[model samples]
Target: MCFSMFRSKSKNSSIIQPGKFTPSNTNINPTALNSPSSRSHSQSKSRSNEFNSKSSSISSRASLSSLKDSLPENPHIYDLSEIRSATSNFLLRPFSSSSSSTSWKCLIDKKQLIVTQRKLRRPIDNSELRRKLSLLCKSHHASLVKLHGASVSGNYLYLVYEFICGANLSDCLRNPRNPNFTVLSNWISRVQIIAGIADGLDYMHNCAGFKNGFIHNHVKSSSIVICEEPALVAKICHFGTAQLCGEVPEAISGEDDDDSSNYHVLKRVGSAVGKFVGTRGYMSPEFQTTGIPTLKSDVFAFGVVLLELLSGEEPMKVHVDSGSGAFRKVSLIETAREAVGSGTGRLRQWVDRRLRDSYPVEVADGLARVALECVLEDPGRRPDMGRVAGWISKYYLESKTWAQNIGLPDEITVSFAPR
Candidate 1:
């Protein structure tokens, strides 16, 4: 887990009330994100000023090329000069409002690409972090965005990914630039969105190589981007906060922490501020207390994203009628549980109104039930992402076009073959 959660509550008190929903209560400024737009270069000065200064004696390109040699052979090590030239001087288009990394829409050999730049908050052994990065780069699943190249320096690390030009799921659902962009309309599509994400996480947690597997650590609605170019599908991006299981530095986890063994898997996450890196609402109660993340933690985050997709609400803020004043801020998880407990009419209040008559009541009920189990306060009680994937598959397969829309071949298999 990378970010802070429940700072005001004590370790004991931070525990989830048996059946309450808590929104990821971050004071996020949503508009700070530049909406993934591509623009002409204000970045040109970066080549002469930034890289030139960084590389005074030898060429900047030569310095960057040397860094590239250490990584797995596939990804190119572009010179800082090349990157600055491509992005017009490191003027980044925001990827997410909360993202600490800066990104630019770049063109290489006439192909449009997205390059993200980040600096390590603390020094990490280049070999150790690079090995993990290479695993993700090589582990290409359709739902996982492809890594084009990378440059990992102790000061600043560069990551290049395929730019899925479509809007992120967060913007597409709640604050869509176009009111007509109804890609998230029906139950099948929404279910497909959840399934696609589950598939990617399944692969990462199980298939991605690590002695203990990898954890996305940061899973949320905004982290998911929906692509419509070749087909309609959702993909996860911004791996800047993700970490390998059981590899946390002792200093970050604190040797005296009770969950120290399980907490071993964390990263300093490139922040001078030194707080945890994940959103509060999506974090599992145990992780909030212990600072240790397991595959189950990711499952909990997915559950929150599922709730967001189902309800068409932001994970950070949900409104409840306070009776005395304006709608008070209630956690989305708490609201979800209450909505499910109360009758169908109450549930409808939380459901995204945009779906209108398109959603099937039985399917909605099934989703709520599954999602409820996912957000369970007890980590052991939560289903693994593999089983989570299975639970949502049958309902999604009900739509034949759905598979084709997400670019899955005909006769696709929906079960998770977890190891």
Candidate 2:
């Protein structure tokens, strides 16, 4: 059924044959169609198609390799030859901007490079750790951060990545008095960001490779970078503290706890010590009280991030009960509940004082629901990250669709803009 080409002679002239034409006896080699002086026209087309198929297969394999090699612990170390070929003799220069203990520069060839080599506080061999990271990197969707390429030399690693130049979500919330503060992020953006974070986590836990259960052990403001667009893109970063599930023994099956009160499951059962690990405010209640760490614990940390994004205040700093210092605060969720309100309605005072008249009630309420859901004490009660991502994406789609349908002004873009 494969139609091809041929040359025909009409009296004194030669032209391409015009009709359904397939090789009658099939003598075509199907590889040299590109040759300038192929004697048979029919053979040329067949050969061209064969070359295309082979090229496509090679492209697919290359893509698979790219996805496999970028894990943090097992970074795809690029051989000098490959890099030289990609960058046309490695004549690239460093980026000019430097901040936050890392120097970020774009290569002349348009590749982004991050340069930092903090002396490892502890030395460890983790090739297996890098493989687990590969699993996490490959499963990313819109909600998750993208991992590009990385290199290793002794204890130092050079992580080359897609450069996202945007301020962390905290800056906007912290400086409400600025002109840009007037265009302050709304509750909708918060919901979208929170939902995206949850989805990224869910993918790591359930749908990723057989051994991929990554608990982003650290989730905080500095870690999330918001993109410059509507429906804010929150990219999760800094996996230095991440724990890959399969590499270590699974003490209780991931499905061990159906009961919400079973904090005991979070306690480390084997040789691994489960002490005070992640960032303070974001740490789960179970992990804070008892040294138990689980996927739910990560969820709890995500909930704290969600609350901070929505309220425009650090979760731990929001509810001050007279005597307790800012750093020595109690449960963020409890304080957020009191600040946002109890049961029926929200408290106006609890809203970020800086938001002033800008924050809308509906958006705030929606974020509250997402934040509360993420922070629920029982792990079972919390929605999985996939479900969270779906809900967030649905909300985003619906908002855009509604605006389009009603002909509302599309003035809202998620990036930080001046009032």
Best by lDDT: 1
Maximum-TM-score candidate:
1
> Which ranges in model 2 have alpha carbons more than 4 Å from their true place?
1-75, 78-110, 115-130, 149-160, 176-183, 210-212, 229-232, 239-241, 244-254, 257-276, 289-293, 318-332, 339-345, 352-363, 393-411, 414-419
RMSD to the hidden true structure, all candidates: 21.6, 13.1
Q: Residue 398, candidate 1: how far off, in angstroms?
A: 4.1
- lDDT of the structure predicted as candidate 2: 0.54
Report, for every candidate in turn, its global Cα lDDT versus the true structure: 0.64, 0.54
Native RMSD of candidate 1 (Å): 21.6
Estimated TM-score for each candidate: 0.67, 0.62
* lDDT (tens digit, per residue) of candidate 2 on 1-419: 00011111111112558898786786756567556566466577789889998999999899888867643333454443544444344344433222322434444245444432222323334575466446645554544545544544465444444455556556555655663462344544554556556666776666666443556665677666666544345566644334432212345554335543332243235544533444657776666776546666766777777777665666665445567554444565776778666642454555655555344455555566777887887666776555555665666555545455666443446545444
- Which segments of candidate 1 are over 4 A away from where they belong? 1-73, 76-79, 92-99, 176-181, 244-273, 318-323, 398-419
